[model samples]
Target: MQEKIKAFMDEVRSRNGHEPEFLQAVQEVADTVIPYIADNEIYNGKNILLRMVEPERLISFRVAWVDDDGEIHVNRGYRIQMNSAIGPYKGGLRFHPTVNASILKFLAFEQVFKNSLTTLPMGGGKGGSDFDPKGKSDDEVMRFCHAFMAELFRHIGPFTDIPAGDIGVGAREIGFLFGMYKRIQNEFTGVLTGKGLSWGGSKIRPEATGYGTVYFAQDMLLTKNDDIDGKTVVISGSGNVAQYAAEKTLQLGGKVVTLSDSGGYIYDKKGIDEEKLAFVMDLKNNKRGRISEYVDQYPSAEYHKGKTPWEVPCDIALPCATQNELNGEDATTLIKNGCICVAEGANMPSTLDAVHTFQDAKILFAPGKASNAGGVATSGLEMSQNSLRISWTREEVDERLKGIMKDIHDSCIEHGIEADGYCNYVKGANIAGFVKVADAMLAQGVI
Candidate 1:
């Protein structure tokens, strides 16, 4: 089995050697899914994994726009239409300086399984540009989004490919992209998710990933006859996912002590209540200030420059930042500090070593594919509402989100339990997500 896995990866690595992020994502899935395929005769004779690794369509183009200074700027843009076995392509569009083919491919590959786990009729895909939205004026960002959508509009549609938002892409950016897409197509459709509520957005769409992560953690705790109440939670990142994660943690009676950005993380020993979290939301979302400003507003908090929040001792830790932010050393520190649960709110936030450390410790660790799937799951809801031309209430949308998270949890448990009675969420998520897509591929006769 190890030899077969190695041979398969060797072939993949030969083609994707330069794409470290994409390779890592594929390696993680291959580790678990290959063994499952070996055991299941239905999947043995097919080269399903190979086909899945290769994107059905990869679109790359140049995006040119004018800056505030009236200077022309050009950036690379990409759309990896990875798979549509179960349904149409569905994922997010990211705008950041770090956007590249490798990162987008990894994200799209992960999206495949993540969407499958949601049990929604959405396939995996991802698109993005290297245009940095940070420090850009609203006009500048809008122009860039428009330029990007001009080229992207031809390849996507309401029934073909749908995109939401990711890092550096938000409601404002989505509005611009959608405006361009709508103008080009001359119709308002469900071609995009994460619109404003007055337009077509779902309730709790902004808070779904954060809230869903906490709900997943709560579900894991429930298995131990415990809950989030009275637990000290340490969270990283102060963006949409982190802020709302803190909000939900407080609502569930947990103590949230940390939130960070690119500059650094702030530690509030007294806990970040709703008031402080609101300040952070404004700081990051509106004011666009550094996290160090947090200590100025509240003297009780201490700002750690150029460091992560991992050193803080807490019962639970949610890594909501970028990929590879939390590593093996951080995992060791968290375990030593007696952290019991680690739920990823960002895609591939934990390094492979970190994940191994957590699993080896027998801690309740939920992967982003299972735990942070709320955003896409809610996006799926938004698509439904768009199709029906009727919006569901906040309570209705949130209720459905909770039910979906619970079902994902149940699916993880059903597939991930080992002989020792411990649940391996990564194994469960990969295999559970794989079986659905693999079956769909089989039924479709290898397209």
Candidate 2:
């Protein structure tokens, strides 16, 4: 069994060796799913994993635009149309200095399974550019988004490929990009998710990912006859996911102790209540300031420069930052500090070693594919509403989101129960997600 998995990984590395992020993602899936493939003859000798790894279409183009200084800038943009077996290509578009083929490919690949778990008619895809949205004015960002969409609009459509937001690409960026896409296509449709409420955006779209992540955590806790109520939770990343995760934790009667950004994290021993979270939302989303400013506003909280929130003792840890932000050492620290549950709010936030450590410790750890799927799931809901030409209320959308998360939780448990009676969520998520897509690919017959 180990040999089979090793050989599969070797082939994956040989082809995608240059793409560390993509390779890492493939390796994680391969380690769990390959063993299941060995047991299930339906998937054997089909090379389905190989087919899944290679994107059906990868589009890259040059994006040139003028900055606030009127200086010409050029950046590379890409869309990895990974798979559309079940539905249209669906994923998020990131705008950051680190956007590259490997990262987007990894994200797209993960999206494939994440979408499948949502039970929505959506496939996996991811698009992005290396253009940094930070420090750019409205007009400058608008021009960049227009330039980016000029090339992007050629490949995507409401029925073909739909993209939402991630990382640096927020509602504002999505609006600009959607505007450009609408102008070029000369029609208003559901080609994009995360629009403003007045312009066809779903209620709770911004909070879906964060809220869904916490909901998944709540489900995990329930398996142990536990819940988030009265639990001390430490969350990393102060972005959309982190802020709303904190919000949901508070609503569920949990103590949220931390929120972070690139600079470092801030520790609020008193717990981040709604008022404190609102301050953080303004600090990050409105003022665009670093997390260090948090201590200035909330004097009770201490800002930790150049450090993560892993050292804080808590019952749960939610990593909402970028990929590989949480490492094995951090995992050890969290475990030593008596942290029992870890839920990922970002795509592949935990490294392979960190994941191994968590799994080996026999703790309840939810991977990003299962834990942080709420955003895409709600995006799927948005697409449905767009097709129906009607919008659902906040409670309606949120209710459906919770139902989907519960279904995903049940699916994980159905596939991931160990002989010892513990649920191996990672294995369950990989295999369960794999079966759906693999069956679709099989019926399609080697496309």
> How much is the lDDT of residue 218 in candidate 2?
98
| Every model's TM-score | 0.99, 0.99
* Model 1 per-residue lDDT tens digits across residues 10-61: 9999999999999999999999999999999999979899999999999999
lDDT tens digits, residues 116-180, model 2?
A: 99999899999999999888899999999999999999899988999999989998999999999
Off by over 4 Å in 1: none
lDDT accuracy of residue 331 in candidate 2: 98
lDDT for every model? 0.95, 0.94
Off by over 4 Å in 2: none
What residue pairs clash in candidate 2, if any at all? none
Q: What is the Cα-based lDDT of residue 184 in candidate 2?
A: 91
Clashes of 1: 0
Clashes of 2: 0
